[model samples]
Target: MKNQYQVHCDHIDVALPYARNSGDGALIGSMFGVCANGGANGADDVLVVKGVFTLTKNSAEAWTVGEKVYWDNVAKNVTTTATSNTLIGVAILDAANPSSTGVVRLNGSFS
Candidate 1:
């Protein structure tokens, strides 16, 4: 047990984006985690970096299994477009066209 070491912490505190109030979710870099507990204005709140999250999407296009997904910072939704988007992760399940959300298998945390 002495040699045991942990690599990453899934939950951490991150500052909320401008105009994004506490309890709201955000996409920080490649991370698409949520805020919980309590925090406000430049303060660090809980951010979950891994898991299957059901987030809002473009809703105009359908998602296929294993398709690469990206986070649209401006639109604040999951999208298939890579241009000007943050690579969040991959779509684990398929979403029918015109849907509002999709299940994403989030990648593990980084430094």
Candidate 2:
């Protein structure tokens, strides 16, 4: 483990946006990561990345496994549509309906 190059990690905890819940897969910019160790708004908590997270989904449309998912900032839910949406990652599990949670893989890149 000497001089090992690390890639993904969950040790970083940064300030959470105002009123942002500690739910897994909560959209943080283009990436959909959440602070598992729930914290108050504007406080720091454990930020977990690179894992399957159950997140809120837009129930208006059904989703299948491997579908491209986007963060609907307006609705505060994950959607399959990309119109005016921020690409978060792909769905690893199917969300049969809206107002439910689906598992997503965190693979969005930072720009």
Candidate 3:
């Protein structure tokens, strides 16, 4: 397979909530990290690693299946969380040839 550039979302509480609130609505605010501070309170530890998904922008808000997205590996395993809300990408099993933009070149961790 070719090299894929996958973004690693920090093990942050803010990120987890975003993943949870994905299908709730459009990216209204906080285009940045919501989990701040080194010794801050964490949500539940549910992590996720998203990928390129479709976005129904300009016209309306929607979570298409081919636009830029994020992902969380640590959270996935640690929390066994659900990213159905704000995530886009196949699991490691179906992500053989990951897209360049939404690929996680992880060795064996989040394969």
RMSD of each: 3.6, 3.2, 14.3
Off by over 4 Å in 2: 1-8, 108-111
lDDT per residue for candidate 1 within 1-111, as digits (tens), equals 687454557777677663454434576666666556545556767777777778788999899999998878798788999998878788999999999889887665331
From the highest lDDT down, the ranking of the candidates is 1, 2, 3
Candidate 3 minimal-lDDT segment of 10 residues: 100-109
Model 3 lDDT tens row, 1-111? 366443455322332333433321112122222222222132333222233222122212122333333333333211112353323333332222222222221211132
Error of 1 at 101 (Å): 0.7
Show model 3 residue runs off by greater than 4 Å. 1-12, 15-21, 24-50, 60-111
Off by over 4 Å in 1: 1-8, 19-24, 37-43, 109-111
Candidate 1 local lDDT, residue 51: 75
Candidate 2 lDDT over residue span 1-111, tens digit each: 777555556545567664566674455665556667776667776667666788888877788889988878788777888999888778997778654778888663331
Deviation from native of the Cα of residue 17 in model 1, angstroms: 1.4
- The local distance difference test score of each candidate is 0.74, 0.70, 0.27
TM-score of 2: 0.76
